[model samples]
Target: MKRLTITTLLAVAILSGCSSTEEVVPDVPPAELYVTAQQALQSGSWTTAIERLETLDSRYPFGAYSEQVQLDLIYAYYKNDDLALGEATIARFNRLNPAHEKSDWVLYMRGLTQMAQDRSFMHDIFSIDRHDRDPEPARKAFRDFKRLLDRYPNSQYAADAKARMIFIKNRLADYDLATVDFYIRREAWIAAINRSQQIQKLYPDTQAARKSLPLMLTAYEKLGLQEPIENTKKLIALNPVN
Candidate 1:
């Protein structure tokens, strides 16, 4: 009897422990979830906001806040440093709402996202030179911002978009200059001259154009290309030296 009684107690304890160990998920309603997410965002609790927003999206795909939640999710993703996810979310939004009246806002945000990514943490924080780094993100951001400007010239976001576009363009010019430098270093004078000329043509008003003239002159002189050397000198004369 004693052994049987002890066995029963053990079984009861095991059952009690199992119950205590079970996970309890909150059964928040979609509307309440969205409210919670908004609260989390206001509090700067990005992780909590992401969780609530994602839960709301999953639980109520067609809820009243569906579109708004998706939009907010992009900002949350960006804030959380999940750039890839943010971009993917933007793509989904664009695909779903191609004619959205607020598409300029989306384009602005997309441009900002790409601009943020183009910024290199290593270069920014560590003081490393990113002139030779990949310029694709900057290029993409420039295009997005340009599109926003073309589509909505008076948009409230246009000023900021234009500012970012300028920065990206300069960075792109620097990237071209970096490539020209690389060719110059390799003693590939003809390649350097050709690339420098292209930079001058493609980025006429850029600092790259200013720098490319000197580079082209050097490359032409190196190769005894007198005609091109004289032409490069004339181009350099167009920019008055400070």
Candidate 2:
């Protein structure tokens, strides 16, 4: 009977221990998870960090750390080189928290992400190892930089974005001039003139248009197009020094 009583007590103790273990398995709060994610990011485990951060954002959308996690997840995506995802996350953050303290950072990151995505195409043609003529990516980077400058003129990123914008605009004007020159070589006066007109209208401040106007006027004279000659004369009158 004493053995039976002892076994009963042992079972009760075991049950009590199991209950206490279950109760002691604490719920990890969102802030703790965010800290873990930050640690993972700092350690360069970007994928794991993203997973943890995404979980924190998803499971604790209303938690105190929710907004911060939303912003950090954009960084996580960028660190992982998932630019499309990063951009989408930034758009979501902007739409949801337009006046968030770090909104400027979000805008800056979006522009940076676009610039990174197009870095390869922004290089000079002589520097390119491949023969592909795709300039669309560079064009996109320019647009992104311009958007940042226009939207957040006083942002911390404004100066850098402006610099990049100038570089991209110059490159784009160069590309347009090259296209016009190619048409000129082929005796495609109309195409050449149209391209020059576009550069003058779209990028009036660019050196390309300033330099191309004289050539375009000569092309119009060669083509015997009276209207174009008159238009070229008008353009020269408007942009007198160029």
Candidate 3:
């Protein structure tokens, strides 16, 4: 009886150990989870896709698939129109995997986020009507595009970034020229000349600067600034587009 009782206790111990091991074991592999997330993305279920990808990242942080999931999470956020979250996730991915294969894509996405955050023309019109021209978003977009150009000059998005930078620069120059025009209208020739000089110095190649030169020349004449008039002439002769 004692031997039988001892055997039963041993059997119970073995069964308990097996049950514990089974409980600890994962039901689905990380790869399976990743595939499900991809399927969710393909199905246009962005929230679910992001959730699964995030889960994979947390559970299998050091796996090769985790890195891919991190990138996928960025895309998922972008697809969901969550630009702020997408940017944040991309930044985190960049910090973790600076040398990742898709780092260029991350940079490009960041630039796109900045572009998206820019105020619309309608908003600009509203602000202008209210005499509250908030140009901060445009300025931020310019800075972000500049960063992309400087850091990833050879990236696939570099050309687009450069084009956008040119566009932003032109807009900025236009704003400056408008201010100078206002000063000229007020007979503040010195102020007008200074504003034009500022544009010329900062954005020599912009069309706004070219357009401002003739006005600048007029301002210099009205202000009786001979040296500036000659310098303006020299600039026009050098540029030949004014």
Best by TM-score: 1
Position 188, candidate 2: lDDT: 89
- State the lDDT of candidate 3 residue by residue for 1-242, as single tens digits: 98798678768867875774211223588878888889999999887787788778778889979778877888888777677888888888888888877677777777666665554434553354321244455577788778777877888888888888887777777778888888988999988988998988888888888888888999999978899889988877777663
Error of 1 at 39 (Å): 1.9
Candidate 2: minimum summed lDDT over ten consecutive residues — where?
Answer: 122-131
Clashing pairs in 3: none
Superposition error at 142 for model 1 (Å): 1.0
Could you tell me the lDDT of residue 141 within candidate 2? 69
Model 1 off-target regions past 4 Å?
1-25, 240-242
User: What is the full ranking by TM-score, best candidate first?
Assistant: 1, 2, 3
Candidate number that wins on TM-score, 1 or 3: 1
> What tens digits encode model 2's per-residue C-alpha lDDT throughout 122-160?
243225632224557667767766777787788888898
Q: Across residues 150-228, which tens digit of lDDT does each residue of candidate 1 receive?
A: 9999999999998887778778888988999999999899888888878877787788879888888888899997898
Model 3: what TM-score?
0.60
10 residues in a row with least lDDT, candidate 1: 16-25
Any runs in candidate 2 off by more than 4 Å, and if so which?
1-28, 119-144, 204-207, 210-218, 221-242
